[model samples]
Target: MPHIAVIGGGPAGLRAAEILAEAGHGVTVFDQKPSFGRKFLMAGRGGLNLTHSEPAPDFLKKYGAAETLMARAFERFSPKDLVEWCHGMGLKTFVGTSGRVYPETMKASPLLRAWLKRLDGLGVRFCPRHRWQGWEGDALVFQTSTGEAVRFTPDATLIALGGASWPHLGSDGQWANIFGKADIALSPFRPANCGFLVSWSEIFRTKHAGEPLKPVTLSFAGNEKRGEVMITEKGVEGSLIYAFGAALRDAIEAKGKADITLDLRPDLSQEALLKRLSAPRGSQSFSNFLRKASGLSPLALSLLREGQKDLPLDPEVLAARIKAMPLALTGTAPLARAISTAGGVRLDAVDDHLMLKARPGVFVAGEMLDWEAPTGGYLLQGCFSTAAIAAEGIKAFLAPA
Candidate 1:
């Protein structure tokens, strides 16, 4: 049996190691961190959204252009399969109202604990704090915890080192240089599913720093998504902003700013809003008037005040502007705060099976691949799906008979 080396202890590496070890192969997993699943644990802190319960087609579309490439991996081990696998390991799951599947325990710790036990029983080995530094004369090299160099010559290798985000928990993207030297095209890591920075007036920042903008429609570049966003001391983030992160991010990257328009009342018709604005204000406070006539939520009122350059203006124009409030996002919040990463190994550098074209016997999987998706379990879905595919590819390569 061939000995396989899986570099990374995140979802992809763990999944692949379990599969190979169970199949009677000697599998060893390596990670620089002392423990496995740091990022995975952080992801579960908010509740482990494993995969969405959405239909397969819609779920697959969440992957964007990488759909065909990732679909192959997912088809063999789809979201339904993931739930079954979790259940077999004594982890029960349920689908949320938003269609995101979560464990009955609602925390990834229970499921992860069971998963690690299963892998241990399969004879999988885990090497902690072993930082891979790429190949050294046809042998893999890593920096040992004791500041010594160690080498290995496995029959196959799978690199799921993850993307450049949340460096404290590992996956610092320091591995990017190794691939660049290996002649693989590297997509510079950037923030995905991240918040954007919008400079709000000091008053608004102080007043509504942690406020929630619920049931609002945020539109950018001709696309709109309806969801709640949270106002931060520095900027804004939430389901709606994350849904259109790429569009806003690209605009900021290219033109230095992204204009986003928010529809305070999406459900109301323009004529109806105009009628509501035509009603007499009778010199009531701005907040009280908006609450009584416009029916804007508290958060909406705060946002409206922030956008209002000059108060006490004509009610009609004010209402029209409030109907479509424009705000310019200056830049990204920060990579460390990103839920997932945007850039990684470009697809052109890898074969259909995700094997690095320049380096044979080396495969890539998980978020390290060049693809990004909105949250709601899609990110985790891609990780496990790609790992399954990598396992099959390794199987074909080591023993084609």
Candidate 2:
């Protein structure tokens, strides 16, 4: 039997190992972390969003520029296939109101435990704290936790070391430089699904930091996302901002700053808001009156105040401002703080099988590839789908023709 070595214990590497081990190959998964799935567990702290329930066509669109490349992988293991795979592991899943799929327990622990157990039964081995350090004359080299070096020469190897996001969880994107030495094409990593920095007033930052603006609409570059965003000490972040992260990041990169519009009262029309603001201001303070009239939260009001020193008392002006308040994003959160990363091994560097054309039998998958998707379960789906595709490529490579 051919021996296969899988580097990085992320979802993509694990999935690839499972497929190879089940196909009768001797497989060993190596990771620098003390345990596997540290990042996966962290991601599921709130709730494990496994995949989206959106149709294949619409779901594919979430991948943005990588949609075409990812479509090929999704053709084999799609959202439906992912759900079924979970079911096969005895883990039942349900779709949330927003179409995100999660296990019954809404935690990743149980599912990961079951998966590890299954791989154990299939004779797969895991070597933890073994960090991959570039190759030594076609032999894979790793540095042990105790500062010892180890080497292995497997029949095949798959690299799924995730992106630059959540570096503390193990994936720090150091592989880019390693592969670059091998003459492999790589795109520099950038923050994705990340927050942007806004020069908030000290008063607003001190008061509204960490406060959430719910039921708000954020529009950028012709794209709009209706969700909630949290005001950070530096700027704003959360679901709504993440949806436009790539565009916002690019805009800031091109123009030095991005001008975004926030609809504080998306449900209320300008006319309705104008009528409400036209109401007489009695003994009630302006804050109290605006809150009752427009249903704006304290955080929303603070955000409004951030835009201008003094809000317009005129109903028309106030209504128009309320309808579309401008916010300027100066910069994106650091790549380390981003939810995920964009840019990686360019698609052209890898063949259709995801194997690096310059280095045959070395396949790449997951976030390490030059593809990115917004949050909302698309990231996990992309990881799993690409892992399956790469695993198939490995299997075909090892099989006798």
> Between which residue pairs do clashes occur in model 1?
none
Weakest 10 consecutive residues, lDDT, candidate 2? Answer: 300-309
Give the number of colliding residue pairs in candidate 2.
0
Number of colliding residue pairs in each model: 0, 0
Write down the lDDT that model 1 would get. 0.87
Give per-model TM-scores. Answer: 0.96, 0.98
**Can you write out model 2's per-residue Cα lDDT over 176-273, one digit (the tens) per residue?**
98999999999999999998899998899888888889898888778887999888999989988888888889999999999999899999999999
Best by TM-score: 2
The candidate scoring highest on lDDT is 2
- Write down the TM-score for model 1: 0.96
In candidate 1, what are the lDDT values of residues 1-401, reduced to their tens digit? 79999999999999989878877899999999999999999899989999999888898887887888768978768999999998998988998999889999899888889889999999999999999999986789999889989899999899999998898998788889998887799888889999889889898898888888877888888888888989998899987898898888999999999999888888886678778777877989756776877788877877787756665466667677667888889999888779889888998998877888888989989989999999998999899999998888888888857
